[model samples]
Target: MSKNLVEVRGLKKYFPLGDGNILKAVDDVSFTIREGETFGLVGESGCGKTTVGRTITRLYTATDGQILFDGKDVTHLNKKDSKALAKDMQMIFQDPYASLDPRMTVEMIISEGMKIHKMYSEEETRNRVYELLELVGLNKEHATRYPHEFSGGQRQRVGIARALAVNPRFIVCDEPISALDVSVQAQVVNLLKKLQKEKHLSYLFIAHDLSLVKYLSDRIGVMYMGSLVEVTEAEELYKNPLHPYTRALLSAIPVADPKEENERHRIVLSGEPSNPINTLAECKFYSRCPHKAECCKAGLPALREVKKGHFLACSNADALYVDNQGFL
Candidate 1:
């Protein structure tokens, strides 16, 4: 196995909800991304997939935990250290339209990171900026244009170009294609994969798209209510997801084969998700778990590998119960 480029241990983040209540946005999340590989984080909305990405990139400081980059601790870096760290990691936000500064031209936007880091002279920065545009499938002429002048796909490509300006080793891709049309999503994803192979960059790709994750990722991590419920290779996750939440999530993905789509059953989760602000030291899915037992309510399950390289939180993978009888 390749050495881990980034390893997170017991990562936690919380937001105050007033009156002694706290929103546990991210709780005790842990994972590792090997160098030159993409690690996909998949889950439903508000499950802290985005938070995990942001925290990894240090956009949001952790309340408690350790984030080690290449065996060096990075939880609390001073200004200089943070700036130095920025060169090694970058982030591509969910909304392309919102991520860019409207006031700046495409050239300015792409070179902004280089300017802050004092990486290049004026001419060198300008030359490199245009080079990035072409590398991302745009033209030198487009560099003079504004962000609003481009289509959604084009904008995303620009966002990617900007992210690459600093020559980062890791990128926190926070649902980079969620805002684009179906036709454009594949193009963006393919471009990312191509770049990864060429640049040998590692990624913490955060999204809810299981099919897409399986398509692009080497390994997959499943999160539920701010906690990672399962981690395994991409094929293993699709074939034998262990946790109840992961199995249910995998079951929900629509299969392409008409026969399979028609015959396959969808796992419909009952009850509501736990509140992020509540005291949820126990299992967050306890309220909706079909196979919930006495021990499950007492405490949340810890992640343990049932098979080699296939880690899961739920103790009983073979005994998974589902209430979606007629639906499946």
Candidate 2:
């Protein structure tokens, strides 16, 4: 079996509002991404998916919990060690245009990480930048152009190249394709898949798009109100989702066939997602879950394996599963 490349245990990140309140962006989330596997994280906007990615990548420090990257504790690494760790893990930000420095050329942007890490000589770095540009579907000639000169998709390609320039083993892709046009989204996803296969890279793929997440992920994790409520293999998640949130999310995906689309019942979740500030010890999804019971409000349910490899955090998961029958 492939070893876990990243292990996040009880990871929590909270921001103080200074009025005796805290925004719990990520609260007690735990999961593992195996070497060379894509672990998809899906949820609605403001659900802490991006915060999870950023915290794992060390862009934001964890308020609590452990982050083990390739067996090393990254939650409190020294500056030198942290700088060294950068070569092993990199992030592809959600917004390509905002992530890239507008003043810098593509070549410079791609080479910056390598220069910081001292991966190669000046001559080799230039060659590596050219190679990276081509690797991400951009040509060597395009490397000299500024970010403003390219379209959104092309700029994202540049962003991908910059992340790859460091030759990292793991990447946190923070909704990398969300901002691109629909026509270009698939192309970027394909490129990412191709690169993953060729480079043997592990990805923490975060997005709100269920269809895309299902397509590219080896395993899928459903997050709601800053907590992971369900996690299982990609196929298992679609085939037998136990959590109400997961089922609701899957139901929202539009079927391409008209007949199937018309026949399917959409599970529209009621109420906005629960507030994450100083959350109570109840199911984070309690307000939105149709299967809510008195037991659900007793306390926060611990994530437990209901079946082999399928984990759920609902108090009445088994009951919900039985009740759903053919629906889920």
User: TM-scores of the models, in the given order?
Assistant: 0.95, 0.97
RMSD of each: 3.1, 1.5
Report the poorest 10 consecutive residues by lDDT, candidate 1. Answer: 319-328
Give the lDDT of residue 208 in candidate 1. 94
Candidate 2: tens digits of C-alpha lDDT, residues 1-328: 9999999999999999999899999989999999999999999999999999999889999999999998988898899999988898999988988999999998889999999888899999999988898898989899789999999999999999989998899999999999999999999999999999999999999999998999999999999878899999999998888888888888988988999999988999988887788568767787777988989988668789888898888888666574456434
Tell me the spans in candidate 1 whose CA falls farther than 4 Å from its real position: 318-328
Model 1, residue 3: displacement in angstroms?
A: 0.9
lDDT of 1 by residue, 194-279 (tens): 99999999999888999898888999999988888899999988876667788788887888899989988788888667777777
Alpha carbon lDDT of residue 226, candidate 2? 84
Candidate 2 global lDDT: 0.90
Q: Could you tell me how far off, in angstroms, the CA of residue 125 lies in candidate 2 after the best superposition?
A: 1.0
